[model samples]
Target: MNIETIISKIKNALGEGVDKVSDEVEKSQVFEKFEDSDDKVAKILDDAGKALTSLFDTIADKAEPMIKKTKAKIYEGIFEEYRKDGSPYGETHEGFMQWVDEHETEIREKVDDGITKTRETILSGVKKTQEYINREVSKKEKPSDSVVDGSSVTDQKSSDKE
Candidate 1:
């Protein structure tokens, strides 16, 4: 082939190679852009999730006291209704209520004393059980007097026979 034709062919091949390389670079850039966008979307979603969780937490915090108050009111209403329907210990609810009101302090003291005595009795029982357990465990852990003194039962029996 002539030099000119050879040179033109080489130039054409180089140009095609450069075009392919450019296309590949463009494709890589597109892929990188998609990855960046996906990361940004994920970050935004995470932030939104966090914000929603915070909002719910704040709502619960603010609503908790109100819910408690409402529950207390409902319980009070139920008790009041029961009282109106006459849950009295004596003849006439008013007299029963008056008697209870008069002896409220004494009743509370008695109840408290009973609770304290019961707690003391339970604690005493528990302590006795613990002491018993400790004694039993210590007996098991210690060597017996016969074993410590190096006298086996058979040796003692033979000595007694002699």
Candidate 2:
């Protein structure tokens, strides 16, 4: 049954058995128990939340440099597209670096979008990883008697000859 019903039953059982205190005292006691339970749950949730936030902050900090490096690599490829043609058509190294510096917002959005898409794709594959492994394992053929368990190939071959 629900928590409230269970608490009510407990309160009733307490009221029927106890004679020293009145109904108000029993209820107050039950309420106090509930408050104590709620406080414990809240504390646990608060601690978990803090830990999760810290983990995310740590991941973001570690990812920041890697993200900038990837963005620069992408920018270089884009810069190369214009450079292959030569002259004013392609951006000079300084011009390309300036462009990257100036378009920070756009670059960040693109990088974030790439990260989100990559995460989604990876998670989708991860969910099926166990199933894929199980399927492949099941499809494998069993070993013959000549290939005894724990025996080396040379030993198995000699035993087979015998």
Candidate 3:
């Protein structure tokens, strides 16, 4: 039914029946060999995992300060310059507000001029558009009794007279 029984029967048929102690010894040796190899594989894997973890940790620890320093440098270069010089605008919020106050009249004049010009241009365009629409509507509304079915207003009138 099982491998051991089959082996035993075959051995017995060959007149070399297996001893129980010998079978047990062989099974124990094979089991121990398997266990030893398994332990070895587990140790190797554990060591490899620890080494990889340590490598990544070391890389992260070394890179953190450099990354922070780079970010600080970039911020300093861009924002610090703007804070100092205030290019086309102003340096700070108060400075920007003061600049706007100083130029308030000029800004208002330019905006008013732009709006007036835009309004005049739009009014002229609208007048021209309305004239074109009116011409088209009048043409369609005016009656010319030129019949599409080969009869005219004069022909119908003459027929009625008859």
lDDT of each: 0.62, 0.67, 0.64
Between candidates 2 and 3, the lDDT winner:
2
**Best-matching candidate per TM-score:** 2
Query: How many residue pairs clash in model 1?
Result: 0
Q: Which residue pairs show collisions in model 3? A: none
Ranking by TM-score: 2, 1, 3
RMSD of each: 26.2, 16.6, 34.1
Q: In candidate 3, where is summed lDDT lowest over 10 consecutive residues?
A: 144-153
What lDDT tens digits, residue by residue, belong to model 3 across residues 30-118?
A: 34544764466567768999999999899899989987986576545544444554544656657655655765686567657766896
* Candidate 3 lDDT score relative to the true structure: 0.64
Q: List, residue by residue over 1-162, the lDDT tens digit for candidate 1.
A: 764454455447667554343333444453454476446656776899999999989989998998798667654554454466575554566755675576568656765776689679979998999999889989785533333222332334545579
TM-score for each candidate, following the candidate numbering: 0.34, 0.41, 0.32
- Kindly provide the TM-score of model 3 when superposed on the true structure, using C-alpha atoms: 0.32
What's the lDDT of the predicted structure labeled candidate 1?
A: 0.62
Question: Mind sharing the TM-score for model 1?
Answer: 0.34
Give candidate 1's error at residue 69 in angstroms. Answer: 0.2
Candidate with the greatest lDDT versus the true structure: 2
